[model samples]
Target: MLAVLVSLLPLVRVLPGCHCQSTNATAAITATTVTSVVSGSLTSKVGGYAVFDCPVPLEYVTRRSRPLVIRWTKNGHTVFTLSGGSLTTDERYEGRTSIVEPPEFSDAIATSINVSSLRESDTGDYECFATHKNRDLQLTASSQRPPLPSSQPLSHQSSTASTLSAVGTDIVDAGVRIKLDVQGGDIMSIPPINQTRLEHESVHFSCVKEDLESTVQWYKDGVPLDDLPILNGRFNVSLEGSLDIYDAGLNDNGFYLCRIMSAKGTFSAGAFLNVQYKAKIVYSPAEVFLAFGKPGTLDCHFHSNPPLTKIRWEKDGFLFDTYNVPGVYHKLNGSLYFNRVGKEHSGKYTCTPFNDLGTEGPSTPMDLIVQHPPKLIVVPKVLYFRKLGDNITMPCEAENVDNKSPAIVWQKADGKSLFDPRVTVAGGNLTLTGVKSEDRGVYRCVASNIAATISAETELIVEESLFHQKNFGLHINSTKKNIVAYWKRPYSFCTVWSRDTSLKLSNWNATATSSDGKAILWNLNASKEYEIMVSCREEISGESLFSKSILIHPKVAESDQLSLQELNKSTGPVTDSFDIRVERSGGNYNVSWTFTDNSRKDQADVERYQVKWYDAFDGKELGTASTEANKRHIGR
Candidate 1:
């Protein structure tokens, strides 16, 4: 009798410290053989492949020359077999089935089976059985459906992998090839994008592209811009991007875009094209006129970002040789220069300037008025004064014509310009202050502008003006041997006494108070005489004239001369009357006398009277004694 038993076994994967149970059963029976069988199921689909192997039995025995055979069956039909480590194809699958590795039996080893290039018809459940002496194990496999190919273009979208099931296994699958669209997104960068510019300067623009692999074509306003002088085969395409113009032109001024096509894509971009042109000077140098050989300054300025081109000088429409050529620093603002400026240097000049745009600037015409000789005149022509030591000044004036302030030279009759130290010239006028006797001369002022060939002269007579000098006179006095002297000056002017003989007065007391141009002095002595000389003078002209000198003496009293009859006053006609008196002081005689009716007496009767007295030496009256009484009085 044979007994069949089925049991389910739980598999434990080496869990920690779990005890395993083993069971053994022994039965005694009449000589009967039992074979152990193990089986599993496998599945697969079209375009899919899988493998299955029989599990090793729990109980086994060693046998000699025992061969394990793997049998492949389709729907319970034997279709192929694997043995001796070699796989053999059956008639049903002669050209369809292949095994990468043939199945072989071993004591305790499992085998692997490989199927390749499966088809839809190959989808099915397959049973694989391993047969050994008295033992057989079967395993079944089922093939599911193969994955479908994706229809979307990979070039347009990102590539993705799809999960596919074949014989109960998942696979990463892909379908179709992808490529980039050559004309998809073509773009060109605008050239000359930055417009950094300066007035009167030129600039350039170009076409640039980021992608250089495409055929580049430049266009302007939707029209192909080909064969341009700046564009050529050598400049067709550049890594820096595209064609560049050496210099931008006004005709080339437009929006330009470059078109390019490549396997990657097509691209185009607008290029901002700029043609730089130099700015022109709207006006030229202005003309200036000046007197020939005279000092003059011309002013000209230009209103431009770059300033003026070159400062040029001209004479009478002809370029001045002095500044005809450009100087090292001549470029820029306008120029100012005086030609030889002689009488011939006067004329109109034109200033011309050219701009970067090759445009000529407007000409500036300047008219020059040259005055060669200066005009001179005098404010007060005639001057006068009274004293030799008086202050005076001579002033000369020039004409106000020509609106030019000229230098005035005050020339004296001696050709010497007014005493250098005493003369001053300012604002076309010459002045001489503190006029002295020597300052009396013909003074003339000359104003000149040689360029204008014109001059004027004015004559000045610095005469001593009456009110100017007013020295009045010198008062002199003396007491005993001491003499005191003081002078009076004119109020119209201060009197100065100069050490220089040429200077009538050197010391000038300007502050000396005067009552009408006259200096006064007080406390003069009457004893000693003085010799004083003075002259009257004018203030502004410093002129002195009319000098006078006089001597002064003390007044004598009648008692200075004495006679007895003058004392008696009774003597006929009082011929020589004397007032005599005796004084004890100094033991000297004091006498007073005067002629009686001196004018009424006849010339013959006006006799020379002899004064006689008892001389201390003689003690007797001389023959000229009038009487004995007079003699006695004298003796007393």
Candidate 2:
């Protein structure tokens, strides 16, 4: 009789028709895997028959699937076996037990068995397992591609029922417990003796009592022997009637019982097996970056079943005991304390933690890098010679002292802020454009990092090399009909140029007859494009220095010329000129000059538009269209 009545629901997996490795594919879909467990208690009266129906193990045996082997075991001994259509029954179970279904499609029902003429003798644990034959051949036949050689060997040793199967073959079993209480049953003792052992050792639980038969079986923690985590072949029922477990493991420790059938009745007893193991780490030291002369700490923590007795530390593979080293001490809370971190303390470190039971791991080592300020590798130059308007740059390079890079800036050594438009610093380099005398000073490249800030300075002197100067640049202001050009006092023989002048070069192009740096071209032509530039020399006979060329497009009418108002305001060059206008009457046009400021009025009256451009504008002296476009192209 049972303590209470409970309704049990049967949920089974629907499998496909026969294929060699169909069950292996089901392993991925169904939860009724190798480790699936089922446990229940059964009772039978004296001199009567008992029938046990196992929970359905879906698709465990499919007709036409493969060569199959089935076994029904009590304790670790086979009570009945069916292999590839061949059936064998253990001597004591031969006529007493019979299968509930036909042997062919045992797939429709779980491993169900019946026993007749039940005596008090049949009390123990029973397991149902199915094994497939031709393992390698079955896996090979199901391959879509050639199998690759495994780098690491496959493992069959596991600590849980879920991991009991590997490639090629699978072991499926059901959990069952049977108890027959005829007489002398309640005589077993309380709090049975303990069978304690270390990991990986062998253990035995004897069921021998002089008059008992060899049909005895074993149970562990109320689970059938085959359902224990050790499972399969490692669990054996010896001929002398003892439960033998090989290569005992931590998970194997549990309450074990031995049940025997004697001439009088059933005898059973149990004992607890205690297993001991080592400790494991939970947290340890990590990479740390601490400035020199600062306090810091490293940590280590662990856990274990038996608890750890000691902790070890290693630095670059050598013992690192904080108590043995100066300026450092070990803390009671399992941390290393540093009085002041120094360069010598920077290196890879690892923590090895262990308890009395055992030790876990610190797979990777951590690093400690000491921090310090950056240092300059090379200093900037003391003197640099640059033309008054040319650009200049200074260099400053630095190297990391303790694996930390520094932030850099460009500044004046005299603590002056760097607000000049021409000054910019990048990667410790300083640059200045349009160099002038007032721009001269002691400039510095400053570097700062977490540790400290430092700087390097150099005195720079700017000189007016040759006759080149920033103010010497050309400026043009013109209308559609007239063009006036003027320059400063320091230069002489200022010559005007045009792209048309290059084509008839070597001949008619003559220098302007003016001694002062001033000239005017009064063309009275508003509908033409002009390409112009200026060249001047320190003396009339000196080599001419050229300025950037200018383009006056038709309809623009000095729009660009008025845009230079700010630049002209700063240079303050000579400002005297004349303008020319054209008046048209019935297809005839009149050209006239109007002088402004009157500073160069005498030169304008003599240079009239009719005497200079009468034949040129009419195209008599110009070349073909291709020649004109090619000669005046801006980049040319």
Predicted model with the maximum TM-score: 2
What's the lDDT for candidate 2?
0.50
Distance from true position, residue 132, model 2, in Å? Answer: 70
Candidate 1 Cα misplacement greater than 4 A, ranges: 1-289, 307-336, 355-360, 379-636
In terms of lDDT, which candidate is strongest? Answer: 2
Give per-residue CA lDDT, model 1, range 1-636, as digits (tens). 322221221111111111122222111112122122122212222222233332223232123434666666665566667665567765634433444332235343323343322333343445445566645632221132211222221110112212111132212121101110111123333322323334333434344444566477766656776655433432234564555553343455565555666676664444344444443334433445565455565554443323334444554667665434332123234545543445454567555444443423435667665654455555534333335554444455666656766565556645654547766766645555655656665455555543343333333333343223334565544433223334554435333221112334532212122224332222222232333334444445444443344455554344533443354444444322232333222433333343335434432443444444333222345334443132222324
Summed backbone clashes in each candidate are 85, 7
Report every candidate's CA lDDT.
0.39, 0.50
Candidate 2 residues lying further than 4 Å off, grouped into runs, are 1-192, 209-222, 239-241, 258-268, 277-306, 322-347, 353-636
True-vs-predicted CA distance for residue 217, candidate 1, Å:
44
